[model samples]
Target chain A: MRVFAALVRQGMKVMLAYQWENYMGLVGNFAFLLLFSALWSALLRGDPEAQARMLSYVFIGQLLQNWTFTPTWELAGRFRMGDVALELAKPLSLPVRVLGDFLGRNIVRVLRALPAFAAVGFLMGIRLPDWPQFGFFLLSAGLAWVINASLYVGITLISLWTTYFDQAHQILDFLEGVFSGFYVPLWYMPPALAAIATYTPFPGMFFTPAAIFSGGLQGAEALSALAVQALWAGGSLLILYGIWLGGVRKMTVMGG
Target chain B: MLHALRCYLLLVGAQARAQMQYRFNFFAQVFSMIATYMGQFIALSWLTDRFGSISGWKLEEVILFYALAILAWGFAVSLFFHLVSFEDQIREGLFDRALVRPLNPFVQLLAGQSPIAGTGQLVFSIAAFLWATGRAGVVWTPLKLLYLLGVAVGSALILGAALVTVSALGFFTRRTYTFYWSLVFPARQLVHYPLNIYSQVVQWLLTVGLPFAFINYYPAHVLLDRAADLPWPLLAYLTPLVGVVAFAAAYGLWCLGLRSYVGAGS
Candidate 1:
């Protein structure tokens, strides 16, 4: 915990230096929200219930997405530069330290997105979730962080072996977005695609939380969703650990 | 011009072999690229499935918009990566190195990088274009066939010009990534849907100010034999001419921006 706190403090300083990027992200988010709101409102014209639910789904789904966003673009360079070795040489264990870094970055992102989400939500008529749902949302959100971090960091760690995935990265990014229900809620997806999305752990990232918050999944269904998310979270961490063992061995053999 | 074309081919050919050395990497890249490039089209299908059509444009018609845009953008990006990624070049000081060359920096930069990442996108676009042609029930004629090829080349030029124009801002500004995103994002995102969904003001803004419409929307409409909102439908045939003019204007901007560039001192 102490190590995590220290890392978070250090990460915040790094984040502060490049704060303008977050500001621009906020602007971009608002623009997309405005346009999507207009598009959905027009697309689902007669079905007001579905439309309202969708607006909330998009709003909260995208807001939470802002928190757990893991960038793949820099994976090739940062890992290739021997930075991973420096992190490994630290006194603490690596996965924990990386989690600390991930957590801290997300803290900054979530903080930046709050006002933007609030303004957009209010303007777009987002009904505030009840207290119970809000509490559950926080829980689901924590699990979501685990799922997203493990999945993305595991993929990023693959750069140790093959330092180039520029094209793969683009494809993975798109697949992740669509599968995670970030682009559209899985409910609205074609029946086959939606079913396929359910079987994948990716939906634990955004859709699970979005559904829980919007009360789309409730009571027994919500508990089952949380259980599924926990399953993915645990599964991802294990895979990440396994990948790290292999990657570390490769890195040492390469004499980096 | 012939010499420049030869140099571009030589540079790209050399790197293409190196990139192909890892067969596994090549296949993974191509497969992943197809998936990534399919995102917008997938969304278009899903939306069209639900809504029947978007603002009077049928699924096939909307797919036409998507396939053409991606095809052109892919070609532009693959061919003119230096321009598409100009901000990165500036940051890494490569743009300065290009400037110091005796040859035109534009040509030097264009000839330097060969990115095969867009190959999958181009292939996917072709597949989508054919599928859309079948679904949209458009009859083909020799002129239409000729027009399609012209539009592809013309749209590629227009997209390349836009990329160069935005990247030129890098010469005069410290950070132009957001501006690049601002320009490119709206073009790719909003342009996928029919122009009629947007307000008259936005339609006008896209048509005249940016002329992004000419890249795919106008040309696709003209080819599909759909009635467009343009006052003179004949203006549709002027796409290639418009593309040449846009590229020339953007090239002029590049020259102006070049004059202002004080190299990022080593």
Candidate 2:
């Protein structure tokens, strides 16, 4: 706990030093969200039902997408730089250390995003959920962070074999953009594509949580979605641990 | 000129050969690019199906615009990858090495790094262009064909100039990535549809301000025989003219940037 806390503190300090860049990133994120909202408004100009559903989805999806935009490339770069090896030499377990770093980084991002979110809400006339659902929304967001971090860490571990892990990160980014319904709602996707999205783990990262927040899904449906998120989170963690062990063994044998 | 071109070709070939050594990585990069392109196209297709038409442009017309832009962009990226990374090269004093070469620094810098991955985008763009052109069923008049060629060349130069101009900004800021993204992200939006689909302000920005419309939209509008609010039937030919202007301006900016680039740390 003490080690994790120390790492978090260190990560926070490093992030804070680059505070201006984070501000720029926040502004960029807000601009894109506004762009999407405007696009949705244009799309749903005539249809009230679609306007309500799409506005809800867009609002919640933007928030979820922003929340889960993990810097997987940064993690992969660290591994490529052999910094991960030095990190492994520390007393902390690799996953715990990565989780601490991600949490610290996300803390800064969340703080930055909050003002933008409120501003967007005010501008777009989006109403926040009542207290109870807001509580669940926050909880689901926590789970989403865990799922996203584990998936990114797992993907980065593949860098041990593929030196061009940045390529993988790019591919993953494209998939997230398409499949997570950040660019378009899953329900609005063609029937075939939406079916595929339903089965994929991507929805757990953004779509499913966004749906829950927007009150598009509730009760049993929301529970099932959370269950899927947990499954993916657990599966990703296991895979990452396995890969880390294999990579460490290979490095040890090669005298790395 | 021929000798410079030959050297450039040889340099590009060598880079390709070197990259081919990492067969798996090269293939992976190709596949990743294909996926990215496909994803964007899919999104555009979905939008077209939902909206029927954007402003007055049909799906085929929009795809035609995208195909040309993509092809030109692909060519620029592949041919001038080092120019794209000019900021980093300047910072690391790699430009000094090029300066020592007998050839023009611009040519030498372009020859130093070729984006082999861009070949995939080029292939996809060519395929898309052929398919979209065939589907659009436009009569290939001699004038139209000449105009198309002019548009492609002009578009390539304009895009290349824009990329280089952003890269040159690194001389002042010492950080090129942000500038590159700012240019690229907005440029991607331009390729999604015709400039006419946008508001008048956006049209002016794209056509005159950024001059990106010369890359595809204006020439395409002419070829399709579509009437534009802008007068002059010969306005389509202005694409190449705009390209020359943009390239000259970019080159001038690059010279200024070079003056600012102090070899190493201060």
Candidate 1 lDDT tens digits, B130-244: 8988898889999999998888788777877887787787788756676556456655666766766676776777777777788777888776886466567876787787788
Model 2 per-residue lDDT tens digits across residues B18-60: 9899898888888787777777777767776777766566777
- What TM-score applies to chain A of candidate 1? 0.91
Off by over 4 Å in 1: A164-171, A252-256, B1-6, B21-24, B82-84, B115-117, B181-183, B228-235
TM-score of only chain B in every candidate structure: 0.92, 0.90
Worst 10 residues of 2 chain A by lDDT: A247-256
lDDT of 2 at A116: 76
lDDT of 1: 0.76
State interface RMSD in Å for all models: 2.4, 2.7
Query: Candidate 1 lDDT, tens digit per residue, A90-207?
Result: 7886677677776787788888789868886888779978988888888999999998888777777777676654654565578776888776677778989888888688788888
Pick by lDDT: which candidate is best?
1
lDDT of 1 at B61: 93
Candidate 1 collision pairs: none
- The candidates' DockQ values read 0.40, 0.39
